[model samples]
Target: METNLLFLWGTPRSMSTAFLRMMLERGDHEVFHEPFSSIVVQGRTVVGDHTVTSHDKLLRLLEERARDHRVFVKETTEYDYLSTGGDRIPYAGRHTFIIRNPRSVIPSHYAMNPAMACEEIGYGNQVEMARRVLAATGERPFVLEAEDLLDDAEETVARYCRHVGIPFLPSALSWQPGDQKVWSRTSQWHRDAARSSSFTRSEATYEATVDSDRFLYDCYWHHRPYYHVLRKWARTTVAA
Candidate 1:
């Protein structure tokens, strides 16, 4: 059997943790969550079970993990910190990009971290990483939209499974509500997701208030163009 290493990359508030939970329920792949966040935010050397800080070591660890079992790693594009204007990690495997509209992502992200920078929002990094993955693998990475995934969880997830060469199991559509073993208690976003038994459409009203907050409004514009570039390629029902 061929061991697989799948990377699900996204920006904050893109429903990434929730997707990670779904993947965890598959019960076949070894799942990792936010292994690179600490390195990007704190300049730390260790994240989760992987202690090596350098990009080369991290890639080697991933390869080692996948030697016997399929590995699923859900991380954010903020790990662009590992890159110096080139491919951050040299390992080649399935890459999936999860994205949310800036209009939705910005307000929720701002609420979580009021001092968030445009760079930390990660839209540009997501795009850059996707391009690098394409150039390296000569394959277009699967692109998913959080809204679409919520709109039709089964269909969207089925499409995702087919795209990534995983078996489409209905059981992955939902999981027991609460934090998975992989998440840290420090992430408020993951905590909120852990509270859900299933994917729920975000009812948080940001549209009405986004323009009122001058700083947030500007940040939204900063991420808008980058969001559109990926949104055009996002996998939706129409594509399915």
Candidate 2:
């Protein structure tokens, strides 16, 4: 079995897709892209896709895949639902969460699903998701933000190596954006957000996204102290 089975959970537009891309490029570990976790939000209905239904069967399948490898990454950010409901994830190794600024997150998340509006689930849902994962795992998995990864890809990969206790390899720095690909689960709304394009929000949208900042902060105080420190260093370097 693999020494590590990295399970990532988060909402749509949280850069989990990009992480999938990056992990695939590592060229060593076999990454399972959204295999076991299916999107089922309100309990009665499921969303997006469902190629398989049996969790135990799926887990067995994954274990077989991990039998010989050193690391296996399973990504299903939509599994934030299970975490939020106080469920335990039975898997080897640590659990991690990839996060983006909820300012950017709200618009993109709502765009993927306007039904996930703050008014319905309350603004705190995003941060609460992080809190729940940490509480359940009781391990502070590396909190890698999209901005930091984009700013320094090499350092970001290195951080992953350090956090997961893997040997730091430079190969992760340059990965071929896979040629023959699978596209069933990807959505146009997310593809647009994945770009470096600017989203000019009107006052109404801005108000809605910004109003949730407090709730986000409350849910993820674990990130704020370090975030502020990094932000200050970033500002000084950029200003020079």
Candidate 3:
């Protein structure tokens, strides 16, 4: 059977890892977490237990994997650093863009990497990728807000699964808390997510402090408009 590919792309600190974990729990698909990221960080792609450094070779490997298994991939938009061609890959798959409010995403991302650039946070890239996917498919790729997903994971994820033509397994809504070889173990964000078995509402607020950090504040405002643009088209309830 030809594999059905599903790409779940998101910005930094958007609960993407948690969502990826949910998909992994389903056991119905072969899940890949940030394949390009592993390549960029380790200078190679790890196939099964071996590593391959050639980009063309890596694509061929992925193609082979997809031929026999349903594949679910989750990655941040920051992978754009690796190639301009990243957007082209999802044209063959169903794509979903996940976003979070900059008020929350900015502070969390800044805490991890003070030197992080605005583009690295990924709001602009998410919007651009969605536009590209829409143009290529003549259908808007689903947009999911992190806050909404966390607010009601079961419902949100069920709708997402339906839109992507997947069976909505109750098992996919939760998972064991720990690291998976599929993701980068060195990432602090991934580590934090690995500690959680399920999504929970955060009471955290950063608005007051955003104005105090000049760089973060600027990036926050710069991306806020774009975030809203995507939010306007986001899929929230089933009616949407």
Rank all candidate structures by their TM-score, best first, as comma-separated numbers: 1, 3, 2
TM-scores, all candidates, are 0.89, 0.62, 0.88
- TM-score quality measure for candidate 2: 0.62
lDDT of 3 by residue, 1-240 (tens): 124777888887888988888888899888887776666667776777658775455555666777777888787776563253344564566778888888888898887777788888888877887787788888877888888777888888888878788888987677788888777645567766778788876555654347788888888888999898888888443346
lDDT of each: 0.76, 0.49, 0.76
lDDT of 3: 0.76
lDDT of 2 by residue, 42-124 (tens): 23212123343445444544555556664454444434434443244433446655555645655555545655534332223
Model 1 lDDT at residue 83: 59
Which is the winner by TM-score between candidate 1 and candidate 2?
Answer: 1
When 1 and 2 are scored with lDDT, the better candidate is 1
List clashing residue pairs in candidate 3: none
Clashes of 2: 1
Q: On residues 126-198, what C-alpha lDDT tens digit does candidate 1 reach at each position?
A: 9988777777777667788898777899988888888788899997777788766687634567766888777
lDDT of 3 at 32: 80
Q: Which prediction has more favorable lDDT, 2 or 3?
A: 3
